[model samples]
Target: MPMDWEAEFVFRAILIGVGATATMDIWAVVMKRAFGVPSLNYGFVGRWLGHMRHGQFAHESIAEAPPIAGEQIIGWSAHYVIGVIFAGLFLFVLGVDWARDPTLLPAVLFGIVTVSAPFFVMQPGMGLGFAAAKAPKSNIARLRSLIAHTSFGFGLFLATWSAAQVFQI
Candidate 1:
């Protein structure tokens, strides 16, 4: 019933979502290392520790340390994993068969929709408002957020395309 590139396989859509998430993680790491931008943070570790001590649930906070080689590796790995999982969920919702024929439109839209999870859970914990809305140094940061999300969407489409080719579906 869905418009997959192939009829017999829907796994390609899941592959696309996973690939896209991975692409974004890699890009984030490269940008952070090369351009001195901060990307993925493993603040969840710190947050969990905080909760254990305080017995109160708290949000994950962003790291304040300067990025280093090891940090980049660990952070980017986590980032990629998160992306893949999120995309995987979307693919599951779309149905494996339908995913085989994934169109850029749905995949990208899914990216946008999923971004809200980070906006609500991560952004505020990092001290930004819902969806990066309250971030100061406004103009550039806002533009950066917009571009980042858009890139994720594009990555999702690309991943889907690549998966389709690889799976021959």
Candidate 2:
């Protein structure tokens, strides 16, 4: 049987995306604080932004504050919106059948594209020089971020598909 199109599901999917990404950021924070590793926490993107006036580079190492209350809020919002968009695209391609197929290719593509927004605006503002591309030692960090985002896309497809089934929508 063909599945029904659902605006509500799509919206929820976006919400899920936002929640999931926020989870990623939170994990990142825990990793940094617990281990003293300077990993990219959720606030990493936005906080670097706070330093723009001083010509601080995004890739430059700096002290980290305890996770800010605000960054998580904004970061989660961004994640949800991006997730909604990806689910929308999947809906467009697979129609209601996205619940069935949920191809990884399109999801990954959507993620790569979504990443460009931060790369263009936040990265430069934070002094990372074009999505953290401008760092003298940016290659690894850039690749890692890319991989993480792609993983996010994959997670979206899996979660949405699974949710669709579990909800029996």
Candidate 3:
């Protein structure tokens, strides 16, 4: 009972997403412990999303937004879901053949490219302005984002490479 290509693709995507996201989380933890750098509070993300139910898409300050019940859970879940979505997008753009024999450059480049989401969309929507222009420490926030996204790219390559080995893809 060998798995079909589609099924395998789904499994691989899930693995890659979770693995890459976990790698980002590990990096966050390391940054926090080593340099006292703070991580983005997913609670704010949840609150942002939660507000969508009330026809609110953007916030003046996500932090000042009223808390939504179970916002943390929602935000965390959304975070991983977004990761998985990105993985799927990566595969779609690169194709299944790439998954079978993954490379680093494309994965890392893609990860770096993904930073656009936060800089343009999420940041503005959360009231930080473009690329966190309104952030208290905008430059630091931008740099951290670049680093984090770069790590995510590395994670993508690592996950894909590992999956290729384990699954014999």
Candidate 4:
């Protein structure tokens, strides 16, 4: 029974992460097609990670940085991996009980908290300046990021609910 519980727990966490990430990606596509507001390309994320190997932690312009091999693959892979990691964190902090019952507030807060990585670490490292302050209409970019992250929170909750339904929990 313990082994079964552990397996279910691991499976559910991965499902939640993947489902939430898929939701976030869908939101990004909608934002791009509907608003003509482009989000940062994951290719750039790959580029940044690639550059990090050379000790280049910050870039003046990530776009201008020389392209790295397999950047798109690297970036996309990392994005999903990060999502899974966050989901794992959520499970770790809240425990198996939360996974069974689920709650909105915690999921939402976790999503919002996830923004710190991009806002402080990824944005600055990518040379977009703090919270994308250097981007055109920086406020808009920041707002979009917040909205997107919040959406991710919703995704997490939705995924958890879906899982609960499947397990009939």
Candidate 5:
């Protein structure tokens, strides 16, 4: 039977998403253990999302906000779902050929672009201010965010390449 292109893209995109997210998570752990830098807790992510319900799109400090039940679950789920969405976007924008040949630059560029979410939307909404300007170590935070996103780009590349190899797609 001939394979369906739609099914292949969806399946591979999901695999790539999981791989990329895993890579990002691993990088976060390594940074924390090796450099004493901390990663954002998903609980804060949950809190931020939860409050988005009451028309509260922004906060002064998500950590200082009231906790919501299942915030942790919500945050973690959002993290993974966002990853899958990014993977889908990558595939949609670059097409399946990119996945088959797997270039690093495009993947990395996409990863950097994704950082805008945190720099603009997430950071400000979380009350860290734009680009984390309100944070004590704003520059450091910005750099870390860059590095993390860059790592995610690499993750996307590796994931897509691996998937292509495994599925021969």
Candidate 6:
């Protein structure tokens, strides 16, 4: 029974993560079509990870980095994996009960807080500087990130709410 419960928990977490990440991607598409905002190139994320294997953590510009084999696939896979991990973290922090009956504020806050990953670790490591301070338009970049993460939070809520309704949890 305990194992079954654990398995179910893990499944729920993965579902929530994937759903939230997909929501963010949808938002990116909408932004691109409606406002001409370009989405982040996940290929760069793969390149950064590939370089890290060679002890090269920072790059002047990820775009200029030598392309790694299958970088696009690697980056997209990692993106989804990271999303699942983030959802797992969210579940751990909020507990299974939240998954059973999710709310908006907490999920949204968690999503917004996730922006710190890019602002601090991912951006600096990719040579964008802290919080994209070095970007051509840092403010716009920051705002976009905020909106994306907020959307992820909303995704989390939507996923959980839908799950609760379907699973009757």
Tens-place lDDT per residue, model 4, 1-169, is 2447667668878899998888889888998899887876899999999999999999999999999999999999998899888998888899868878889999999999998888999999998899998977889878888988988898899999888888753
Model 6 over residues 1-169: C-alpha lDDT tens digits?
A: 2336677689888899999999999999999999999999999999999999899999998988899998888889998898889999999999888898898999999999999999999999888999999999999999999999999999999998888888754
lDDT for model 1: 0.61
**Across residues 46-154, which tens digit of lDDT does each residue of candidate 1 receive?**
4433444445433433454223345445545656666767766766677665544668888678767766765676666555657766666645565555556666877
Question: For candidate 3, lDDT tens digit of each residue in 67-106?
Answer: 9999999999998898888998999889878988999999
Pairs that clash in candidate 1: 4-101, 5-101, 10-96, 16-160
Q: What is the lDDT of residue 168 in candidate 3?
A: 76
TM-score against truth, every candidate: 0.64, 0.62, 0.96, 0.92, 0.95, 0.96
lDDT of 2 by residue, 92-159 (tens): 66565565556667666766666676677665655567867766678866765676566666666666
Q: Candidates 1 and 2: which is better by TM-score? A: 1
What root-mean-square deviation over C-alphas does model 4 reach?
Answer: 1.7
Stretch of 10 with least lDDT, candidate 6: 1-10
lDDT of each: 0.61, 0.58, 0.92, 0.88, 0.90, 0.91
Instruction: Please write out the lDDT profile of model 5 over residues 1-169, one tens digit for every residue.
Output: 6468898789878898889988998999999999888997998999999999999989988989999899999998898889888999999999987888898999989999999989999999999999999988999999999999898899999999888788775
RMSD of each: 5.8, 5.6, 1.0, 1.7, 1.1, 1.4
Off by over 4 Å in 4: 1-6
Number of backbone clashes in candidate 3: 0
Candidate 3 ranges beyond 4 A from true positions: none
Query: 35 in model 2: Cα distance from truth in Å?
Result: 11
Candidate 3 lDDT trough over 10 residues, lowest sum: 1-10
Write down the worst ten-residue block by lDDT for model 4.
Answer: 1-10
- Per-model clash counts, in order, read 4, 2, 0, 0, 0, 0
User: What is the full ranking by lDDT, best candidate first?
Assistant: 3, 6, 5, 4, 1, 2
Sequence-dependent TM-score of model 1: 0.64
The CA lDDT at 145 in model 5 is 91
Lowest-scoring 10 consecutive residues by lDDT in candidate 5? 1-10
